[model samples]
Target: MIRLEALAKRFPPERQALQGIDLEIENNAWVLISGGSGCGKTTLLHLIMGLDQPSQGKVFLHHQHLGRLSAQARARLRANIGLIFQEPHLLQRRTLWENVAFPLELAGQFGRALRQRALESLEQLGLGARATALPAQLSSTERQLACVARALITGPSLILADEPLERLDPQNAALVTDLLRARHRAGGLTIVQTCSESPATLPDATARYTLCAGRLVPSGLLER
Candidate 1:
């Protein structure tokens, strides 16, 4: 579960990005940080992922204060949280499988075990056929899938995706969304995704909240 308490971030002349965000995300939940551009949706993700520290509030992951962690501790904590950025964010020089395996290696798993795990991840993401393909050669949707596979291959507890289907055509987008829902259904998986317009991704979400004017507004009930 994730909790945000009095979360406020201000950039002096740039205006306030978030103001007094108080919310709770339960385990086994899929919630969209619904919002328009510049509404601090992405900023909220950063706070959750511990990529950026809050200006005057606290972010708690499973009841542990994220702000209390050191830099190295923060990295360790992020290993337990998978993130899919708005962009594919893959390395051009690396092959598709290599990019997916990067996180595993960074986590200290290696050798044939690493290769097997990476291959399995690609297989699950339906990118097994393109495992050897380089990032520059893959299509936007393909790269996006690879990025998602990279995140899941590590088996993180939570998934935080920013504009997950930003560039895909309907078909590819649906495919990815379906896969995400399947994972959510499997349990104890907390997924926080942001999309400009809502897509019927998961049926058993915990709740849905909208971000506007730097505040979180309740949208509706989310359940099966």
Candidate 2:
């Protein structure tokens, strides 16, 4: 479960990114956080992922406090959280295999074990044939698929994506969307996604929220 109670992230006098937002998302629930650019949608994800700090209020993951956790504890918390962005953001110098191995390597798993896990992720993304290819060699869509593969390789309990469909055709978009929905259906991950205005269909999001003027408001199911 993920809960944001009176959550706020203020920048300065000129910019109040998020203003006391309140939300509740149950386990295995798929949610969409829709908003205009810089409405604090991505900030919400960052705070949840422990990438940024909240100016005030509280963020809870399975009823665990986020702000008070130590750095090492936060790292452990992050291990169970996956994040995908607008682009793949792979290393230009590394091959697909090496890029996918990054997270596992960071976690201290190494050798053939790390290679095996990375290979499995590539296979899942249907990019195993291009495991030796560098990021420079892939199309934008393929790069994004690699990002998805890396995020899911750890079998995370929660997945957060920021504008996950920025550059893809309808066919490829649907394929990736279906992939996310399938993960949601497996009944363990709490998936939260942020997008500007989606193409009409989204992963079976159980709840939806709209962000405007720094406030996060529920949009509900029938609103779809």
Candidate 3:
């Protein structure tokens, strides 16, 4: 579903975030990428999502080159991807339902269909009763669960999450992990980057890789 070929990203003042990174994620596969801080995990994800352009090389999403696509085309392509960040990044002014429905609303879904889709996603995460609450009103775990619900509401074919479970308690972290695994099993390509090598996140992964000094290297085979 996604491929990165010799991808490299360099920031101003000669800071290289990634160098010679090649990756491939097939449909329905769960890939785990682990790395320390400043190791370019988030930068790599941004390149794959077309949020950032690589200084060298190419990123292909569903066979289309991201760097070569027009802005409108990129936006359209991005609709097929769901991204969950370390922080939920929910809007303070928007209620939980509104935040989860934001993506569908952008796609022009409205009324019953939009509401139902958002509600269904929240229900899946056990957040149905909190739909009317604001982000600040919810607990940290609830906020993260709400983010997962928002990401899945679009039924995206690919999911790119960066340290999604970093701030959750053990119970909440397990819940999020299970949700991600279930989504991948349902045919979505899921790639997650975590700083720590937690068994909850690694056991079910089809493959694993590590980022070190801006390079992508095989970590080892996962048990699943």
Candidate 4:
């Protein structure tokens, strides 16, 4: 489970990014947090992912308090999570398959087995034909799809996606959304996706909330 208690964050010179946000998300649940830009949606996800510390209150992942963990420990915990940034962060020098195989390489896997696994991941995302291509050679949508493949290669229990659909066209957006929904239905994946769109846009979300001026407000789905 993931829990946030009175969570808050502040920037220099009196900028409050988040304030007194309280929330709880159970395992294997698909939750969507929707809001406009600068509403603290990204801030909340960063706190939950242990990438940043909360100024006040606490964030707990599976009962472990993130604020109390050392930076190294937080990084160790992060290895098990799948993270999809708003922008694709692929390596310009590497092939698509190589980029997808990165996490596996870090975990000490290599050679034929690693290459095969990476190929399979790309194939699942309909990027098999582009596996040998460089990030610079792919379209924006394909690059994002590659990012998704990389995130899922580790088969993480939790995925944190920030504004995933923000820049995609309709068909591509549906492709990404359908893939996430299929993974969730296949079981044991908990997804926390943030979007600058309405909750209704994500009909597959099991729970929904909105971030408004640094405050978290439960949507009708949550209230139900």
What would you estimate as the lDDT of candidate 3? 0.82
Better of 1 and 3 by TM-score: 1
* Winning model by TM-score: 4
Q: lDDT of each model, Cα atoms only?
A: 0.85, 0.82, 0.82, 0.88
Q: Quick one: ranking by lDDT, best first?
A: 4, 1, 3, 2
Candidate 1 C-alpha lDDT tens digits along 1-224: 89999999887786899999998988887887688888888888988889898997899997889999897988888887888998889988988888999989888888988888888988876789999899989998899989888888877779999987887778777777877877787776889988776555556666788898889987887756
Question: What is candidate 2's CA lDDT for residue 207?
Answer: 77
lDDT of 3 by residue, 110-190 (tens): 898888888888988888999999999999888888888888888887788878888788787778778877777766455
- What TM-score quantifies how close candidate 2 is to the native fold? 0.88
Task: Give the range of the ten consecutive residues with the poorest summed lDDT in model 1.
Answer: 197-206
Summarize candidate 4's per-residue lDDT along 126-216 as a digit string, tens digits. Answer: 8999999999999988899888889889988999999887767887788888888888888899999999876465666778888888998
lDDT accuracy of residue 23 in candidate 2: 85
Candidate 4 Cα lDDT to native: 0.88
Candidate 1 vs. true structure, TM-score? 0.92
For each candidate, how many residue pairs have backbone atoms clashing (under 3 Å)?
Answer: 0, 0, 0, 0
